[model samples]
Target: MTRQSRAHLTDRGAPTSRPVSGPADHPVPATARFRTFRVAAFALIVLVIGGAAIGLVVTRLLGPGATDVAAIQVHASMGGFDPPALTVKAGQPVKIEFASMDSSMHTDGGGWHQFAIDALGINWKVGPLASEVFEFTAPATAGSYSWYCDICCGGKANPQMQGTLTVTG
Candidate 1:
């Protein structure tokens, strides 16, 4: 065979001038580039909205400022709670501050008072001569809800230990 024919048929360990074609070699279409840009922009927008929503949720769960009313105070003594009845708006956020006005020497329940309302999932406690503050949403439906101090002040038997929560529409 001729020298030229042998070179064409077999490799001589030398570089070739011909270029290999692949994805990198070809230019991307304008439509494909735009589609990728659109997807990226959409993802960014979704991320921003999601982050904002999460931030709002965290802030609300963390502070009592989310409630419309400043805290309403209630004092617990051996006789009963001051302001035997409370009025609130239905479906509204409320903040309550319950305080124990008696010393630990009280005989009812050792001066440890509890504020509980089973229907609204409220159960709070306060030490003798101390106070506690908490927040909760009023029931959706307007109605009367009963509250009591089961500890330091008798459970539910004492008329003085009972209080009524009036939720209005």
Candidate 2:
């Protein structure tokens, strides 16, 4: 109620307080803040650009054109073909890579196994630890074709080394 007390009171009769500054309250220069933001933005841009470059390179390497050639890898062991079944689109070009994995002792001199599909006219002798690539177009008709090892594992009636190729439209 005194003049000195009234000087510390606000219009609503509450005490007035002054603002206090701490170490965290220090103002940063506009250029310094902008430089930090710019560096972060540049790093983000570089990351985006690098990701796009990698995607482009991968697309060029494994695009549809590269996949136009159907690459199939079949391993032959004592059991049979590894996959035992293969599927391809009708009239599509297919590249089959056959590997003979049979390690049994051979006295007939026929190597380990022989891949043959009498219907498709695909017959290739694959030796142990060796691989062969056969390129052919799938049959125009969509049907099931059988393949088997003729030499080492007998014929289609034998279930051990027989497989089926399915052609889809």
Candidate 3:
């Protein structure tokens, strides 16, 4: 092809400026284009973060309602509840295992390892052994109940050896 023909051919399929281009290529300035991109990016980030937070909250809400309760075992002399608190079903058997280092209180013979679930109307006593099982329907209400070492025989004055029972129906 001739040089002129080649030049025409090259420009044929290309976008050409007017005899004199306008102020700029775009009606909206380049800065506006950049601002739009930044805004979109920020919106995407917010959506992602918000979705993650919502998912966490939903998972926690739909998770298991409650499970077996536990206690934090502490020496009678030291005086503190093992685990401190626990949760259990309203109509389920209860088990408390005590582990005490107060040889004087829990003599080899048999002292008192009493347990009280006042909410469930359960107040029973056991022995020096660190384990006992009580079969009774827990209180049919969901609330907090306090159980303490009634036998101040716990080597101290009202030792803070107390725990909470969270009963849920």
TM-score to true structure, per model:
0.57, 0.54, 0.41
Q: In model 3, which regions exceed 4 Å deviation?
A: 1-78, 98-101, 105-111, 153-159
The lDDT per prediction is 0.74, 0.70, 0.53
For 94-124, candidate 2 gives per-residue lDDT tens digits of 8987777643354433446767888889887
RMSD of each: 17.5, 15.6, 15.6
lDDT by residue (47-114, candidate 1, tens digit) is 99999999866743332231224689887777787778999999999888887767667676877777
Error of 2 at 74 (Å): 0.6
Clash pairs (backbone) in predicted model 3: 71-82, 71-83, 72-82, 72-83, 73-82, 98-130
Which of the two candidates, 1 or 2, achieves a greater TM-score against the reference?
1
Most TM-score-accurate candidate: 1
What's the count of clashing pairs in each model shown? 0, 0, 6
> What digit string (tens of lDDT, one per residue) describes model 3 on residues 58-96?
743332222334632322223455566778787676555
Show model 2 residue runs off by greater than 4 Å: 1-70, 104-111
